[model samples]
Target: MKDLGMNLALSAEEKSLLELITPELVKIGKDRSKLIPILQLIQEKLAYLPGEAIHMVADHLSISPSEVYGVATFYNQFRFNPPGRNPVKVCLGTACHVKGGDIILENFERKLDIKEGQTTPDREFSIERVACVGCCALAPVTVVGQTVHGHMQPSKVEGLVLRARIEREKQQREKQKNESSE
Candidate 1:
């Protein structure tokens, strides 16, 4: 008898989504065949790939864990760590490159006091760079959460970040006020 490795149990929500994907995985035959979409599904369901889930998926599909890790690392869209409550992705694509993205990124690095791929000490923000966001015409653009600021200048970077911080503080204060009122 061959040991098939550890079996993974999914949470109720994850199981439901996996069941929906079971047909698709089955149709693909090998786990390798289903690997990408499977990963995507899990990421969508769980926000990030749990280590256990990755191992389970690898075992089920007869692939090595390293292979799974490799795939996960290769894709920028996929996040290995749980993203911050707010994730800031600065686009460094070619158009942005010429538009002083380097300076902007540096400013963020200095102001945030954290390198790229790092979250703030308080965990209120996480900074990262993307290859291209297709807003090159606006070059030197920064995306804070979902909002994008284009044509950014070196001098404007600090102000933009400060503005975002102030805005967030305002929202938090407003929420607190509402809670007290309630």
Candidate 2:
């Protein structure tokens, strides 16, 4: 793939990812209309859109990198950074707002030491604010992973963060145990 004059030096992992996705890119064809599909495919495989993948897509479609970035950013479904093992979504709907959802969100930020839309350095947790989680009756809600937590209070943030860490550690240990058995 052409670097488009960016002179990017891809690491071994990036090169491997590019190699894995190149065939799918070819099968999907290079029409401009396929840009979104190409990006989706890459994101599906990599869990996020990396800069190298963006440049490759731009080059493949004969489009500018800025154009690709514009489209990607326009859609909230695309994530530029890798998602954390545990995702925490704080709802800020009208009901949640009235119930102090903002405070709950801030508590999570302080406890996680990362702002909304960012993942922790260890990739353990990520926090984001959502307009609504459709659980207004359970206003002031935070959803960790797939589980919905209702009636959230600022005081609960530490417990929630701690639970997520414990869960992740347990999962890791299980994975390691399985690997050893194999």
TM-score, per-candidate, Cα-based: 0.65, 0.79
TM-score of 1: 0.65
Candidate 2: tens digits of C-alpha lDDT, residues 85-131: 78899999999999999999899999998778777777778787899
lDDT of 1 by residue, 77-179 (tens): 6765445556778888888887778888888888887667766655566778999988788888888888888888767777876887888899999999999
lDDT of each: 0.73, 0.82
RMSD (Cα, Å) for all candidates, in order, is 7.1, 5.2
Q: Pairing residues by index, what is the TM-score of model 2?
A: 0.79
Deviation in Å, model 2, residue 94 alpha carbon: 1.7
Looking at model 2, residue 5 earns an lDDT score of: 17
> Candidate 2 — which residues are off by over 4 angstroms?
1-18, 170-182
Task: Compare the candidates by lDDT and give the number of the best one.
Answer: 2
Model 1 global lDDT (CA atoms, 0 to 1): 0.73
